[model samples]
Target: MTASQDTIGQICKLLEPFNSTGKVLTPDTEISTDLNIDSVAVMDFVMEVEDHFDIEIPLNVVSETHSINDLAMVVDARTKKA
Candidate 1:
C-alpha cells in the first residue's frame, strides 16, 4: 500500500477505541455521526492524531474536517510537508 493508505489504516486503528458501538469504520465514515464523537472528544481525538502523526493540525482545519478521509487527507498533507 501507499504511504497515505498506510497512514489511513493507522488512523482507523486509532479511532477504534472511540467507537463505542464496535462498528467497522471506513474512510467515508462521518466523524461525528458515525463515530459518535462529541465536540470534546473531537479535541482529544485531534490531539492524539497530531501526536501519532508527529504533526500539528491547525484548529481551523480541524473544525472543517468531517470524515475519516478528511482527516487522513490533512494528516497526509501535513506529514508530506514535514
Candidate 2:
C-alpha cells in the first residue's frame, strides 16, 4: 500500500475502538474533544501509532499533537524522512 493509505489504515485501527459508534474522521478532524479521548488514551494511541508505523514518535511531537490530523501529519512527515 502507499504511505498515505497505510497511514490512514493505521489511524483507523488505532481509533476504531474509541470511535466505534460510526464517527467519521477527516484529515482535519480533532481527536481529543471530537472523539472524547483523554490524555492517557492519547498516550496509548501514540504508542500504538509508533508500533504500527515502525517509527519512534518523539515526545515533543506527541505533545504537539492535538488531533488525528496533527498526529497523522507528524507520522507522514517522519515516514517521508525515512
Candidate 3:
C-alpha cells in the first residue's frame, strides 16, 4: 500500500475503539463530527496516535486536523521524516 493508505489503515485501527457512534470508519470520517468525539477525546486520541506512531504531532496540527485523512497525512509525513 501507499504511505497514505497504510497510514489511513493504521489510523483506522487506532480509531476503531472510539467509534462508539457506530459510524463507518473511513479515510474521510470526521473525528469530532462524524464520530461524535469531543475536543478532549480528540486530544486523547492524538496522544494514542503519538504512542502508536512514535511521532509527536504538534498541537497546531492537532487543532487543524478534522478528518481521518488529515490525521493520516500528518502521520505519514512524520514517519517519513523519521
Candidate 4:
C-alpha cells in the first residue's frame, strides 16, 4: 500500500505510548525527547509497524530511524526493495 493510504495517524496512535501526537514528524524530531519513547518502546513500535505494513523492517534500518518520517521513509524504501 502507498504511504498516504497506510494511515500514518494510526501508526502514530500505536506509538502514542512513545508520546507521538499523530503529527507528520520530521527526521530530527528526536524519538526519545519529542516522543518520550524509550528503547523498548521503539522495538514495540517497530514490531507494530511491521505488522501493519506486512513487512519486515531490518534491525539496522530501525536503528537508523530517528523520527516518524524517518521510519516512514525507511518503510517505503524497504517496501520498494521487497
Candidate 5:
C-alpha cells in the first residue's frame, strides 16, 4: 500500500477504540466531528501517531488537519523526509 493508505489504516486503528460510532474510518472521515474526538483525545491520538510514525507533528499543523487524509498527507511527507 502507499504511504498515505498505510497512514490512514494506522490512524483508523488508533481511533477505533475512541470512535463511538463504530463506523469504518476512511480518509474523508473528519477527525473531530466524525470520530467524536475531543481535544484531549486528539492530543492522545496525535502522540500515538507521532510515536508510531516516528515523527513529530506540530500542534499548529495538527489543528489544521480536518480529515484523516490531511493527517495522512502530513505523515507521508514527514516519513519521506526521514
Candidate 6:
C-alpha cells in the first residue's frame, strides 16, 4: 500500500479505542460526529496519534482535522521522506 494508505490504516487502528459506539472506522469517518468522541477525548486521541507517529500535531492542525483522512494527510505530510 501507499504511504498515505498505510498512515490511514494505522490511524484507524489507533482510533479503535475512542470508538465507543463500535462504528466501523474508515478514512471518512468523522471522529467527533460519527464516533461521538468529545473534545477532551479527541485531544487524548490526538496525543495517542502523536505518540504512535512520533510527530507532533499542532493545535491548528488538530482544529482543522475532522476525519481520519484529514489527519492521515497531515501525518503523511509531516512524515514524508525527501
lDDT of each: 0.85, 0.75, 0.89, 0.69, 0.85, 0.88
| Candidate 2 lDDT | 0.75
Candidate that scores best on lDDT: 3
**Which ranges of candidate 5 are over 4 A from the true structure?**
1-3
lDDT for 64 in candidate 6 is 95
Candidate numbers, best TM-score first, in rank order: 3, 6, 1, 5, 2, 4
The runs of at least 3 residues in candidate 1 whose Cα sits more than 4 Å from the true structure, single-residue gaps closed, are: 1-3
Each candidate's root-mean-square deviation in Å?
A: 2.4, 3.3, 2.1, 4.0, 2.3, 2.5
**What are the runs in model 6 whose C-alpha is more than 4 Å off?**
1-3
Better of 4 and 5 by lDDT: 5
lDDT-wise, the better of 4 and 6 is 6
In model 5, which residue pairs have backbone atoms overlapping below 3 Å?
none
40 in model 4: Cα distance from truth in Å? 0.7
For residues 3-80, what per-residue lDDT tens digits would candidate 2 score against the true structure? 375676679778877664477876656777777788787778788888887888977888887766678778898888
Model 3, residue 57: what's the lDDT?
A: 99
Task: Go through the candidates in order and give the clash count of each.
Answer: 0, 0, 0, 0, 0, 0
In angstroms, the error of model 6 at 2 is 10
Off by over 4 Å in 2: 1-6
- In model 6, state the lDDT of residue 61: 87
Q: Which ten residues in a row have the lowest lDDT in candidate 1?
A: 1-10
lDDT of 1: 0.85
For residues 37-77, what per-residue lDDT tens digits would candidate 1 score against the true structure?
89888888888999998999978998999888889999988
Candidate 4 lDDT over residue span 3-66, tens digit each: 5426455556667666655544544465655766778878887898898778898778788877
For candidate 3, write residues 6-78 as lDDT tens digits.
7899899999887898888888888999999989889999999999999999889999988999898889889
